[model samples]
Target: MSQLRLWGHWPLFLFLSGWCAVAIFLDYLYAGIPGRKYFLLLSGLSALLLGLSFPPFGFTPLIFFGFVPLFYIQEIADRNKTSELFYVYNAFVLWNIFDTYWVANAALLPGIVAIWLNSFFMLVPWIGAQWVGRKIPSLRWWSFASFWVVFEWIHHNWEISWPWLTLGNAWSSLTSWIQWYEYTGVFGGTLWTLIMNILFFQFILNLKKQLSIRKNSRTITLILCFLIFPVLISILIDRNFLAEGKYGEICVVQPNYEPHYEKFAVPEMEQITRLGRLAEINLTKDTRFILFPETCIGDIGGPVNSARVQDDNRIITFYDFIESHFNIPIVMGLTTIKFLRDGELDSPFKRTNQAFKEPYEIANSAVILKNRLEKNIPVYNKSRLVPGAEIFPYRRLLPFLSPLVDKLGGTVAGLATQKERTVFEAGNLVIAPVICYESIYGNYMRGYIKNGAQAIFIMTNDGWWDDTPGYKQHMAFSKLRAIEFRKPVIRSANTGISCFIDARGNLGKSLGYNVHSSINQGVTFSPYLSFYAKFGDLLAYLALLFATFFVILRLFRYFF
Candidate 1:
C-alpha cells in the first residue's frame, strides 16, 4: 500500500521539479545576456513607478525616484557604448501606455498612435543627452537635466502640445505641499524631481563602485534635505497665503448631458429646457453670474463676429431664454465660424470648399453676455487645442499631408485661434472664461489674469471620459491654476463635479460625478498678482537658457 501511494504522487513531484529547473535555467540565461534582462526589468519598474505617481494610483512621492531605473540604464549604456536609445524609447512607451491608456476608451487607434507619437517626442531629449554625455562625460547629468526641462517647456508651447505627463503635475494632488507654485509655477517641482532622481542614481552608482559608507551616508542626508526643504517652504507659504474681497455670487450648473449619446442628438429646445430647469433650481437673489458647461446649447454654429453672431438664431434664442429667466451675466461655450471671401482666407487653418465656393473658419469658443447688451459680446476662442482630435499637428507646414491626417481622424483644418487673450466684464468684476483643456495650462492662465481677469470660470464637458480619473485629474489640476494665480475658480462641468475652488486650492461644495445639479456659491477675487502670474514660468525660461548654453558649449568644444 505504501509503495502504491508513492507511485501515485510521483507525477506531481516531477512536474514541480521541472518547473523549478526551467526557472533556474531562465535566471542563468538572464545572467548570460548583457543588459538585456536588466534593461527590460528596469523599463517595467520605471513605468510602474511613474504610472503610480499620477491620478487613480496617486502615490505622489514615487515621482521623486521614478526615473532612477531609466537613468541607471542610460548610465550603464553610456559606459558600455551600447545603444541607449532603444532602451529609453521602450521605457517611455511603457510609461505613456500605462499612464494614458484611458485615452483609448474613446478612440482606440488614435490613442495608440498618440502613445507612440508622444514616446517619439520624449526620445528627442534623451538623444541630445546621450550625444552630450559622449562629448562631456563629466557634465552629462547636468546636460540631461537641462535638456529634459527644455523639452517640457517646448512641449507646452507647440501646436501638438500635450503636457499631460509633465513631471510637476505629480504634485498637483498634493496642493498643500506645493503652495510655492505661486513663485516657480509647476516647473520648480519638475526641477526638484530631476535633481533628487539624479542624486539618488549617483549614490547607487557610487555604491556599486564600493564607495565609502561615510560618503554614501552624507549623500543620503543631502538627498533627504533637498526633498524635505521644498515641502517645508511650501507649507510656510500656504499658511500665509490669503484672499480678500468678494467678486460676486455665481451659479454653476451641471446639466449632465451625455456627449456621445444625447448631447448632440437632442432637440435644441429640449437641451435648453433641461439647462433652464437646473438654473431655476439654483438661481438665487444674490446670483450675479450664471455659468454653463462647454457646448451646452447643442449642435449650434455661427459666425464669431459680434454683428453676425447676434443675427444667428442660436444666439438670439439663448439670449431670449437668459433674459426671460434672469437678468444677470451669463457665460457659456459654443461653436462659431468666421466667413472668408475668395481672397480672405490667408492662413492654411481657413478651409476652402472644393467646388470653388467661399471659405470659412470654425472655432470652439466661449462668450459672455448680459440682459441689456447691444454690441457683440467678448468671445475667446480656445487656443490650446487637443492634438489629433481638435487640431491637425503641423497642418500649416505640411498641408500636402492634410488628406492622410484627415483619414486618421484629425481635423484637417484646425480651429482658428486669437493671438491675444480676452477678458469679459461683469459690472466691476472681470471673468476669464477658460474652456475645457485650456484649464490645464499654467502659463496660459497667467495670461488671462495679467489681462485683468479677476476670477476664472472654467466651462468644461467632462462626459467625454465619463467618471474615470480622467475627469477627476482635470478637476484637480485646476487647483494648481487657482494657487498659481491667486484667483477664485468656478468650474462647471457638463457631467457634474461642478464646484468652487478658493485661492488656497481648497475644494468646497462639489457635486458628484455624472450628476445633474447646480450650486450657488459666493466667489471672491483679488487684483493681487502672484509671482508666477507676474513673471510667467521664469524657471522654465532659466532651464531653456541653461540647455542652450550647454548645447553651444558642446558644439564649440567639438569644433575648436
Candidate 2:
C-alpha cells in the first residue's frame, strides 16, 4: 500500500518536471518564432518551474533535467549557419538559464552551491558561435566566448540580479575543490566547467574525418582536460568531513511571534517564556552567542512610542527582568519607540514617509541585550526590507496612496527602509547582518563583507510564506552565499529550514521545523576569503561591458 502511494506521487512528479521542461523549450522556440506567444508561455513556465523546485518536491534534483531540452534546442539551431533562428535560440537559452538561477533563489543557496552542473548555462554563446562560426570562421571562437560571457554578465547585473551559476558552483558540487573556493569565488568552477564542456564537445566534433579540424583543438582539449581533471578529482578526494574546530555555545530562539499581536498583546512574560523554554533546551554554561528571528517577540510598536497604549512597559520591562536573570547576551527582533519632535512623538520613519505618521519605528531589526545589562544595547536596523510588507516599491509615483493599501494595521502607518548594509560589532566579532530579502541581493550582501565582516548572520521571517516552494528556494540561496564569499553563515528562520552553512557549503548543525523548535549552532571564522570579496563582481561587470559593446556595436552595424 505504501509503495503504491509512493508510485502514485512519482507520476505527478515526473509529469510536472517533464512538462515544465517542455514548456520552457517551447518558450524558447517562441522567441525564435515571431509572435512572442511562447514568451508568455515561457514566463508562465518559468514561474511554474521555480514553484516546483521548492518544498512540495525537493525535486531540486529534477531542475537539471531542463538541460536536456535546452541542449537539443541549441544543437538543432546550430544546424544551419545562415539561419536567423540562431540568434533567438541563443537568447532563449540565456533566458532559460536565467530562470533556473532565479528559481534557485540565486544568492541564497548555502555552502558551495551545486547548481554548477548547470555550467552549460554559461556556454550558450559558444553554441551561438557554431552559427556565427560558419559565417565568420575567424571570429567564431571569440564571438562564442564573448556571447556567453556577455549573457552571464548581464544576467548577474540586471535588477540587482541573480548570478548563482558562476562556474565556481561546479567545484562546490563536489566538496573537495571547495576548499579553494576562498580563492576562486563560484566563478572559478564555472570557468573550468565551461572550458571542459567546450573542449569535450569540440573533441567529439573533431573525432570525424571531414568535419574534424586537425589542429591544436585536439592537443588543447587534452591539455585543458588533463589539467582540470586532477583538480576536479582532488576536490572530491580532499573533501574530508574531518576538520577540527572549537565549539562555542550559541542559542537561537524563534519566538514564533505573529505580526497581528499588539505591542504588549501577548504576555511578554508568556512570549518571552515560550522562547525561554525553547531556548531552555540548549542553555549551556559556554553559550557564546544567541539569536531570535526578525521581530519575533512583539508587535510593530512597543512601550517607548505608545502612551495610552495598553501594552506598556511590559515587553521591555519583561525582558528587563528576564535579561537581568541571564548573564549572556540575547539577540532578538522587536519594534522600537523613538520620539520624533520636541513635545510630541511620531513614527520614527515619518519624515521619509508622511503617510505612516505613527511615532514608533516598527523596524524589522535585531537587538542585543547583554546579560545583566540594564537596558537593550546596540540595535541593528535591517538594511534590506521586503517589497510589499515593510516597503512599498515604486513609491515615488504613488506616495500618499500606499498606507491605504495595507490589510494589516499597526506597522507605523507608512513604511521604513534602510539606506545601507551595515555591520555590527559585538565583542571581538565583526558581524555582517542580512535580514530576510536582503540575503537574495548578492552585490548588496558583498557590501557588508567588503566593509570587513569576518562572518555573516542572516535573520529571516520565513513564516510569512511557509509550506510552499517559496521557503525552500529562499533557503537554497543561503548556500550560494557560502560559496560566493567563502564565509560561514548562520541562518535562523522563524518557521523552518534553519541551518549553519560553512564556507564550502557544508551544512553543519540544523533544526528542522518538524523535529525541533530552534537551533543554536556554534559558528567559527574560516579565515579564508574569496577573490569575489577582494575584487567584488569584477567578472560580472566585465561581462556586462562586453554585452553592451556587442549589443550596441552590433545593432549599430546592422541598422546604420
Candidate 3:
C-alpha cells in the first residue's frame, strides 16, 4: 500500500519538473523573454502606471518606472527578432484610453479618433529610437530620450498638437518637486524621467544576470542620485524664492452651464445675465478686472465682426453692466468673424457664405470691454486650437477629409489664429488672456511673459468633459504654468475649477465642478521674468539637434 501511494505522487512531481524545465528553457532561448500573455500583461501594467501618474489618481512617483516595462518589451523584441511595434502601440493605446477617455464625453467619434491617432503618433519616436538602436547599438538609450523630447517639441508646434501627456506634466500636482522648472521648463522633467527609466531597467537586467554587487553598486548609486538630487534642488529653490510685483484683485466667475444641454440652448442674454449676477456678487471695490470663461456668450448674434466687436448688442450689454455697476474692465471670450479683404489670397481656413459669396474667417477670441470708448476691441484670437474640435489637421492637403471631420464633430473650416501673444491691459493690470487649450503650452505661455504680461488670466470651458479627471487635469496644468513663469494665474472655467494659482504653484479656493459660483482673489503680479520665460525651451531645441544628428549618422552608416 505504501509503495502504491509513492508511485501515485510521482505523476505530480514529474508535472512540476517538466513545467520548470520549459520555463527555464524559454528564458534561456529568448534571453529572459516571457510568453505572449506575459508580454501583454507587462504592457498593460505600463499603461496603468503612466495613467495613474496624472490627475485624480495622481500616483506621481509611478511615472519614474512607467517606461521600464516598455524598455523590457523592446529588449525582448530586439533579442527574439520579433516586431516590437505591436506591443509598444498596445501600451500607448491603452495609456491614451486610460488617461483621456473623458474626451469621449465631449464628442464620441472625434474623441475616439483623437485617442487612437494620438497613440499612433506617439509610436513615431519609439520607432525612430528602435531604428537608431539597430544601426548604432551603443547610443540606444540616448537616442530614445532624444527622439522622445524631439517628438514632444514637434507635438507642441504642429497642427494636430496635443502635448497634454508630455511626461513633465506629471509633476503638476506635486509642484514642490519640480521648482527647477523655472530654469529648464518641462522638457527637463521629460529628460530626467527617460534617463531614470533607462537606468532602472538596466539595474533590473544586472540583477537578473546575478551580477556581482561590485558591478551593480554604481548603477544603484546613480539611480538614487538621479531620484533624489532634483527633488532636493527643487526644495532648496522653493525655500529661497520670493514672488514680488504689483498687486491686484481679480474676480473669477464659474457659471455652471452644461455645454451640450444648457449653454447654447439658453438665450444669449440669459447667459450674460447669469455671468453678470455671479460677478456682481463677487466683485469688490478693489477688483481690477473681472474674468469670464471661454465662449461665455454663445453664438454672439452670428459671430460679431472682429473689426467692430463693440457694436454687437452682447458687447454693448457687457459694457453697460460694467459701467452701471462697477465700471471695471471685463475680460471675456466669444466668437468673432473677419471678412477677407478683396485682394486677400484664399486659404483653407477661410469659409464663404452661400448667400453672400464672400469669404470670412471665424476666430475663437477674447476681448476686453471697458468704460473708455474705443473704435475696436483688443481681441486675441486663440492660437493653439484643440486638434479635432477646433481645427482639422492637414485640411489643406486632404480637403476630402473635411466632411469626415465634420461628421466626427469637428469644425470643417478651421478657426483663425493670430501670429503673436496679445496681452490685455486694464488700468495698472496687465494679463495674458489664455483661452481654452492654450494654457497647456509652457513655451507658448512664455511669449505672453516676454510681451510684458504681469499676470495670466486663463478663460476656459471645461463642461465639455463633464465631471471627470479631464477638467482636473486641465486645472492642474495651470499650476505648472504658474511655476514656470513665477507669475500668478487666475482661471475662469465655464463649469468648474475656477481658482487661483500663486507664484509658488499653490492652489487657492476654487469653485467645484458643475457649480455656479464666483470668487474674488488678490493676485500679486511678477514683472520680472523667470529663466524659462526668458530662454524658452532650450533643452527641447538641444534634444532636437541631437536627434537630427543621430538620424544623419544612422543614414550615413547605412549607406556606407
Best by lDDT: 3
For residues 97-125, write the lDDT of model 1, one tens digit per residue: 66665565445556666677888998888
Q: Model 2 segments beyond 4 Å from truth? A: 1-175, 187-247, 254-269, 300-326, 335-362, 371-376, 388-390, 397-415, 468-470, 483-486, 526-530, 552-560
Better of 1 and 3 by TM-score: 3
What is the C-alpha lDDT profile of model 3 across 423-540, one tens digit per residue?
9887867899999899999998888999999999999988777667789999998998999999999999997589999988999979998688899989898797999999999999
Distance from true position, residue 500, model 2, in Å?
A: 2.3
Our tally of clashes for model 1 stands at 0
**TM-score versus the correct structure, for each prediction:** 0.89, 0.65, 0.91
Q: Which ten-residue region of model 3 has the weakest summed lDDT?
A: 1-10
1 or 3, which is superior by lDDT? Answer: 3
lDDT-based ranking:
3, 1, 2
Colliding residue pairs in candidate 3? none
lDDT for model 3? 0.84
Q: Tell me the deviation in Å of residue 200 in model 2.
A: 5.6
Sequence-dependent TM-score of model 1 = 0.89
Model 1 Cα displacement at 201 (Å)? 1.4
lDDT (10s digit) by residue, model 2, range 1-560: 01111121232344346545765675576565543433343334433433343333443323322222333334444453223343333333333333343232212231012123233444556555654555445445445545765565555544223354333332333444445444444444444444444454445445533453546466565746655675675476346433233435567665554322222355556666666678767766666666666555445233233222223454454456445445555666655545456554533355434545644445556665554333435555665554334554445565664563352222323344466666665566666767776775555678888777766777776544323344555666676677667677787776546778876667787765423366667666544455777776565555556545655655565566
